[model samples]
Target chain A: MIRALFPVLAILAVWVLLADGALACAVCSGGDDDVKVKDSYVAATIFMSLLPLCVVGGGFLFLRHRYRATPDE
Target chain B: MTSRTTSLRVVTNPRPPVVPSAVLGMLLFLFTELMLFAGLISAHSIARAGALLGWPPPGQPRLPLEETALNTAALLLSGALLIVAQRVFARDKRRTKPWLTASIALGAFFVIFQGVEWVGLIREGLTLTSSTHGGFFYLIIGIHALHAVAALIVLGMNWLRLHRGILAQSTFAAGQVFWYFVVGVWPILYWRVYG
Candidate 1:
């Protein structure tokens, strides 16, 4: 699971990049632009570490909740 | 005293089932979805605040805020109907169809209104590529609409099951959870898109 979700976090890392890098796009513009978005690497690192755990944990809770109750009433 | 027989499918459980598990599942799904959108909205909020340009960009018309507000009303009404449907279904499954149908209708109306408003916004000159405002508006609303679509499918399934027979309360409850998700997501969209 860790191996599989690593890429998603990496991609998110790139998104946070926009928070810091690249000032002007005066010359041209387009989709996904491949522009490095600007953000502190520290913040992105924290997010990458945090979000997937949240996703996995939430799914676990949901599944467990579905089975926890008695079927009747 | 009464005795119970065990079923071969153990996961299905040999004992009588608990209260509606589906309700919790739906609620769980809603919470997960809220987190997902919350992430996006948070990013957008931070980015918008930092933008050299105010949202809506230099020339873009301010959002069709009033139109979107009306759409918000449609979703809120749908939520109410779902609550009513859950109540009726719990007491007597036979008559859930009307409330369920009303909930479904309101759900459909919300989506239709969103689509119309999108078209109007485009006619007024907003496109995903046009500006960051346009980008966030389209992406956020589009994703929320997808959730709404999924919620409708859950409703449809529940509706079908009700017609066929009294579905397990867990299943109906699960459906309600999803319905609430559809309703819960709207206000976040409305505030960011218009406010």
Candidate 2:
């Protein structure tokens, strides 16, 4: 099994090395060095990333509470 | 002589769902919609920040902040009315009709007010192709308006069913989930695009 995973690990290492080249697009790079733009990009990224987690997590917690409140039949 | 026939019976006890399936489905749909709005708002923010001449582009007509605030208040009150309707529905279904009617009326008022606001903005030269500000404003707010209209339609249908006394608890819950999403997401859009 170890020998079988060696090629996959090697390919992953190569992909990681070239990840920066993959993000050279204008959208990914913000296409400008303006301070406000950069800040907006950062803030937006955080907002977008955390929003789904919060929503899904909250929903899950709600369901768990409901389940706990429900009596066993 | 000892041939005996036996009948088999399977006893089943089904437990109620933690969340009704319809409400859960609505919640799932709203989750995706929330992400869509998040993307749109994020794009708008990035674009606004990149603008060199500052936001609203210099020549664009300013958004009607105070007027829209009044409209926002109406939408919020409509949402509050819906909550009251739902509570009344739990206790006495007969009395929920008035509260539900009031909520729908306010929602309609909000949509009509927004339409007037759009007409005024367009006359002031805020067309979609006029400026980046115009483009983002219409794109984001227009999507929101579409959602509001669709939610209104759903609520209208719910009202009809209630009038007929055929609305199921799950169905009403589903409609509430959708309308609440429309109500809840508005303030954020207003802040981001208008403010």
Candidate 3:
């Protein structure tokens, strides 16, 4: 089951990374925050970013269910 | 040339349409907008860090956060109302006009609030060239503002169909998808900008 879910998880990860990568850089606008980008290895949190992805991906899946998914062939 | 019955059968097929391409199209358009915002964020971040100029190129003013936040709230509320409108229309036609009217009114109000905020902000000394923050403010909120205007116009047209009793439930679903996106994406921008 875990292996089968990998593709969906991967797609979902890419979705979040693509979005959160931009936002991570986006929120730091104060000129003197002293954010070290190039040399520092920061441990990013799944809690902050991944939660949003799960919700968005799940929203899309719900929409697909409500509107697109159909019965019969 | 005379196969109306067969065409009807095809239209009335037992299986429902997948709408995969349409879903993909929406996602792609959203991705493009993300790229646009990403570019703005990158420019702003680098400049803020002194990697580039101190932004605004020396002629712009800081944005008035107090007023813009009000407009942000307006837009957020409009989205909530739109969902309400869609839900109302999903069941019965009689309830459609009320919800549609509420949605349309809220959307128009949101746009008007944005306009008023922009005009007031500019008068108070903020401009696209005021400073890095000023430029970022204008570019980020301005793009979203433009999208808001376009969405209101589209919703108005869609509203006309609903008022005239010509729209289908499925079509409402289509419009709602885009509307939700417009509403859904704003908080992220608002938080970043206002912060």
Candidate 4:
């Protein structure tokens, strides 16, 4: 129980630390400190990062399942 | 010593893999490419959101939204045509030729249109070093265009093989996988960059 909890706690701490950086952009012209902009930026970044993974990963998993199901037929 | 006679028989029953190794390899390659695009997109999102004067910035020429929407439709049509070609190829190779040709034509048109659009943008003062907006626009779209060009070459080769009556399913499928990747990635880029 304790060993599993350690990883979860570690992940949570990292997430907290990285939260601020998530709202930052390399090419931004600056001066945008609005709460809405910051929140939307974080959300969009996360969505962009995850969307591709979900698509490609889900496709791979489906293919794997199908491959396993139809063997030597 | 007595002479021994050996008989050889052809084996016709062989087990085939469920998914071709070539297609699987392409999928893995596309996954990595997808990650690269994701990183660029994430940066674009951040830049757009955090900008002081909103996205596209002040004094920059507006992105051609309507023109690109039509281009997007053409690309999607090309994807559909390619699917038809793949399906028909299995049933009749000769019949598949026209579909493949049409698909290639549409895809080439998309690339050509993009080139024209880029020329216009450059003429209008949008370039790599002009601004961050210009930089991201060129970098992201240029990378995608590079992949599209390479995929077109692959598809062209596959078409040549089809003409020679030697287009193997694995080779054709590999070309299709790359084409699909090129097609699949565009809409996201369109929404983010153009829309």
Candidate 5:
């Protein structure tokens, strides 16, 4: 298992090291003094990223529960 | 020999679905629709944030916050009535008609009121091409309106089926899910756009 995880761990370490390089685009970065714009970008990014996962994950969990509750024919 | 024969027999019955296919299909569709709205709302947020002169821009006519609030109440009440109708349906499907009719009427009222509001806004120089504020307003709210109309149509059809004594539970459930989505998403839009 450790050997199998070695590449995955290495990739994660590299990703962490290079994280700051993944900066926002010019439009998203907005004006340096405009806190509201920066905040909105962050909020919107988080919302867009998490919404699908929440919805799809919730749906999956509900279905799984229902399926488990159902009696076997 | 009897035990051996029983073991060899094939099981013909399949496990039933956790959710009805119709309801499941509607849920899946709503998921995609939810994502679409999310994207639009996200874009609107970013645009509003980037507006140097502040949201609604300097010269754009203000959104009808009060009037639209009333309309929002009407839409919410319609959703509530639908839940009531569903409950009534469980007892006596026939008894659900009045509640269902009321729900549909309120929903229709919402749409009509929105249309009137749109006309007023357009006359006030909030046309689609006038400004970014106007554009986002129309685009986000217009897409929502389209969804509302479509959901209302679905509910209307289900109501008719109920009237004709042919409505299935699954069908009504599916329509309910869609109508709820339309109703549920509105408050968020109102807050993000109008508030």
Candidate 6:
């Protein structure tokens, strides 16, 4: 297990080094803009991510409720 | 009184049909696909937020927002026509064919228009590798186009099967479910990508 972890750790180290460039946002980097671009991005990201779950999960729950409400025939 | 005798009987009531399993299965599949698109949209949101320049990234061709709205209307109308087709299928099976044809035509029109728009954008030097905006544009819309094409093919197949009197209700419903996902998902995409 220790030997197996070595390669994983090496890959993680590489990713850690490269991750900074990948994560940096343009708005946060430089800009005198009206709306805080970083905040907008964060808001948009959260909304987009949650939307699918809400839609899909809500549909499933609704269906289940309906199923239970239905009387045995 | 001598001996008493008893009789046992089992009674069963027939249940009405609920949503067909095929349609439900398709719905589940679409749910997953919705998440897939969500991931793409999230990426776009992050990219657009970070974009230092006005989005479309300095000199990238502006997306034809107004023109695409017309196309979006066409797709929505197609969905409406599909509902009509389903209704007509129940009342007058023969009449449903024309409505189905119309729906398919509208869908194809949307796809073709998108292709035209893509050509225009490419001519304007907005290729996939051009910029983050260009790359995401293609990735998101390209995935949608792929789903639309597949859904169209399924709709076409369903149309053929209907004419032959071999189309099962479950299959027909499944096709409708897929089309609904394609149609329903576009407005969100339009707002995100275009707006």
Q: Write the per-residue lDDT of candidate 3 for residues B1-195, one digit (tens) a residue.
A: 675554434545555555645555665576567556655654554555443444434555555567767766776777788788877777777677776677767777877877787888789788777655777787887888787777677677778888789876666665666677778778777665665
List model 1 lDDT by residue over B1-195, tens digit each.
Answer: 999988784455355543345665566566667767867775665456556556667899788777777878888988998899888987988888999999899899988888888898899889998888888888988998998888899889989888999577788778777778768767866886679
Q: Write the per-residue lDDT of candidate 2 for residues B73-125, one digit (tens) a residue.
A: 99999999999999999999989999999999999999999999999999999
Give the TM-score, chain B only, in order for the candidates: 0.86, 0.94, 0.78, 0.93, 0.93, 0.91
Who wins the TM-score comparison?
2
Tell how far residue B159 is off in model 4, in angstroms.
Answer: 0.4
Q: DockQ, in order, for the candidates?
A: 0.10, 0.58, 0.15, 0.40, 0.57, 0.24
Q: Lowest-lDDT window of 10 residues in candidate 3 chain A? A: A38-47
TM-score order, best first, reads 2, 5, 4, 6, 1, 3
RMSD list, candidates in order: 9.3, 3.2, 9.2, 4.5, 3.6, 8.4
Q: Is candidate 2 or candidate 6 better by TM-score?
A: 2
Question: Model 5, range B62-141, lDDT digits (tens) per residue?
Answer: 99999999999999999999999999999999899999999999999999999999999999989999988898899999
Better of 1 and 3 by DockQ: 3
How accurate locally is residue B165 in candidate 5, as Cα lDDT from 0 to 100? 100
Scored by Cα lDDT, where does model 6 land? 0.87
User: DockQ (C-alpha) of model 6?
Assistant: 0.24
The ten-residue window of minimal lDDT in model 1 chain A covers A27-36
> Can you tell me which runs of candidate 3 are displaced by over 4 Å?
A1-69, B1-12, B20-24, B51-61
Clashing pairs in 3: B55-B132, B56-B131, B56-B132, B60-B130
What overall lDDT, based on C-alpha atoms, would model 5 receive against the true structure?
A: 0.91
Q: How close is candidate 6 to the true structure, as a TM-score?
A: 0.78
- Residue-level lDDT tens digits of model 6 in A1-73: 9999999999999998887423344434444243555565567668776787798788879788867877777
